[model samples]
Target: MTDRQWADWHRPQQHYLIEPRYLAGGGDIRHATEFLRASGWKDRSKTGGPLVFHNPDKLVRVVFDPLAQPGGWTVEGRATADRPSWEARFGTGTPVEIIAGLTDALTQQPTAHAPNVWAPLGTHGWEARRGQHVTAVSPDKSAFVQFHQSSPGQAHWWIGARTEHGRAWDAHLSPTTPLSLVQALTTALSDPRPVMRPLGNVPPSDRIRSTSVSVTPAQLGAWQQARLTAARTAMWARSAWTAARPRNRHPATAAPRVPAGHTTGRR
Candidate 1:
């Protein structure tokens, strides 16, 4: 058999799926944070506490605190007098790309219909079990998505992806987290396109469990150039939006002063 056919025969189906950098998890925190900043989310981080960002209207907030229990990264959309609120969290071990999936949805315009999280997982041959709570596992058994009750009248969702060595990443979303954001993350996780990664960067355990495709230097360079072009296009869009909006002189948008007696360090 040719190398391509042989590799496909031995490879786990999930390996053939395209893994976008954002959904692949374990990306640099700066990518997501920078995107938010460019999209007009103000940085309101305190010197010692976790870094914080808030939307211009103050309805949405994102926090990065390595010290926080359960999750180091938290995103919250506060309820207004006429609206409800929502929250999503990610452990320090969670991928920054997965976190960005939510932020991307939050900053973008809404869609007419919600994206289907369960259907895509099912379509990809993930097994679903329903009882007190619902859980889905990828065919290769390296990934999972779950929804369960956290308390009376409280429900939450959890997603985790791992390698043979150990857990790679995980995230949590409260029941109130917007369905659109939830769909964005699920869609990313279940996409069936191959993700490009340097062979050297693949974890040893993952290499054992997945098939790696060789890409010529020229091909890799082209892929990188395409990504750069897309990023530049997004940057230009954000710049235009910023220029068009009226500058908010509200005191809330002003740079916050460090409070006395506050020392910055992970609790």
Candidate 2:
């Protein structure tokens, strides 16, 4: 991390994921890293396979554009150019349970955005890591969430949410450490430009109440009377005005616009 005085990073941050498939007896760690990297995550420890690949920047790239191999996800570019972001998408399951799994494994406080939108951490792509790493067991009804980066002139990723599907996320790669990814992220996160905004619609404020409509019987009677009076007056003037009014089929309607340097009808 850049250690710049002006840099912005959330202190004491902790993030975690829970994959039941990872904890199985036949589980492979390298296979996991491969799947995650393709989307954009990388590991520094080089701990074989799907051990622990943490880093906000790398995680974002992998999340959006994951390199899907036959087995697991792989690490590729740190979704820096693409506004990198992460989304904890669930597949028809309990969000609280999913978050609970991550919290239990990582020993951190896990919150939710809605049903699938989990709690957020870090500024740009920085994640606060703590607690011991554990394997995740993928459920039968797989809850495949993703962390992706957004494209340029498209700041939607930083503000909105992202989703991942079947084969799209299961890509893999050779066992590689995400060291550089973390380093890059640390530098980026140090000097933060945090913009606090709501995920979707900025919910209406509690202080603002819809104004009461004025629909008294007297008002309705008065309005109807006014309308009748105006209609009678317009009926009397309609015939006189219609005599001189131009028709919709007039020749001028089909005329082309004159060129900038030229004159028209006078010639």
Candidate 3:
């Protein structure tokens, strides 16, 4: 095996070691879904269908379906039942981390200085144009974002990263999709910082578009050792805290636990 591949084999699964990349591949959806649950979104999914979540005010809804086509995950915000406000859709291949960017924005209050989607791309030497439609392309011409009118009164937005082999990831947004969400997506896309990844694990297509930076074995070892030491120290501290905590002499009766099972619910 190659030296870099050897290092990847030895690296711990949870280690912080990473390489920067313009577009990272697909990631687990749990992160985004968990974030929504923690952020006060109510789960309203049915047993045999897609996972659905709604904000407390019921004005926003998120749906995730592993089997859905074109877009497996969708988010929609509406002012009323009859009148829709905005919508965003993410293909199955889109990374959860990217999806979280939009979800995070949804939960927070809007800022005065919203992020500029086109400015950053232009600053990074990406081509940007405005006229009948707004569009931007990465310096390498492998990634792009476009906004245009699909039809009268209907707007469409698309963002995608790809290589010669195939598409890396992409997202679609409707006319009313919040500008903040669009900015969140563009911010991530235009970030100068690279995403770390094991050289051996990277797909061949991605390697063609990426600029690899070699990290010495010594540096990798040092980073791993530091993480191990920190983890052990944290564990020891936790153990000590647990041992020192006082235990109740007489514990109260625990409430009956509900059996785990799926329940049917309306979306």
Candidate 4:
């Protein structure tokens, strides 16, 4: 990123927020700090304070705080076109343009290692990635899925889904969750034509509540059996209701009941 470009990235008029986990790793911090230092960016920080880098000739500056903990580091810049005085008083540009620029900067080969950050969402297109936790939204914004590893290394995957009607469902995948199943879910979520199964009206949070981090295969099997039983019960109830209902036939047009010798009609 150019000095001007970097400056533009942190323009006072713009704001950007990226979760800490995505950028908190030691490698990430080292890579970013080294990149900036090697690029001749001067460190004008005070004693025992967060590392601050700036180019005296340009309006760009970055601050890396190791003590920031969960918030990670904060970096800001401004383009040459942005007037610091004017922008500080009144916002110079929209967040969309600013975030787009940041995304572009991060996607570049050298900066890609810094962190994978997702911009704040408004109406559509939301995503966030932090370690084992990953969130993805469909292209049309009608569906969203959040995948995460509930256990540290038990090889378990929990998937949460939200449909157009706000219906939510979640399922636990085994250590051997098939790639085909994952791909199928992605395709189903991306495509709106075919209706997907297991995304019922009930929220997954309400239906599948696993107290433990890792769910055993036996537990999964038992849940499946219960679901099957519930489905059969529903079908039986429907059939019983149909059988109990009176037939829709007119009484006068129906066959007459014989009292004693009224079998002449039949003969």
Give candidate 1 misplaced runs (Cα > 4 Å). Answer: 1-25, 67-71, 150-152, 194-201, 207-267
lDDT string for model 1 (119-170, tens) is 6667666677655566777767777777765677767888887775677767
Ranking by TM-score: 1, 3, 4, 2
Residue 113 of model 1, lDDT score:
60
lDDT, model 4, position 178? 27
TM-score of each: 0.66, 0.16, 0.64, 0.25
Estimate every model's Cα lDDT from 0 to 1: 0.63, 0.25, 0.63, 0.34
Between candidates 1 and 4, the one scoring higher on TM-score is: 1
Give the CA lDDT, 0 to 100, for residue 182 in model 1.
75
Summarize candidate 2's per-residue lDDT along 1-267 as a digit string, tens digits: 666422333222221222221111112222223333332334454334333455323332222111223322222333333223223321111222222232122111112211111111222222222112111111232222122213432211111111232221221111121222222222221222221111231222332122223243344346545644544454445445546763121011111111232221210
TM-score of 4: 0.25
Q: On lDDT, who's better, 3 or 4? A: 3
Q: Tell me which residue pairs clash in candidate 4.
A: 7-77, 7-78, 7-79, 8-78, 8-79, 10-76, 10-77, 11-77
Candidate 2 worst ten-residue window by lDDT: 249-258
Model 2 TM-score relative to the real fold: 0.16
Relative to the unseen true structure, what is the C-alpha lDDT of residue 176 in candidate 1, on a scale of 0 to 100? Answer: 63
Window of ten residues with lowest summed lDDT in model 4: 85-94
lDDT (C-alpha) at residue 31 in model 3: 58
Task: TM-score for candidate 3, please give it.
Answer: 0.64
lDDT of 2 at 132: 26
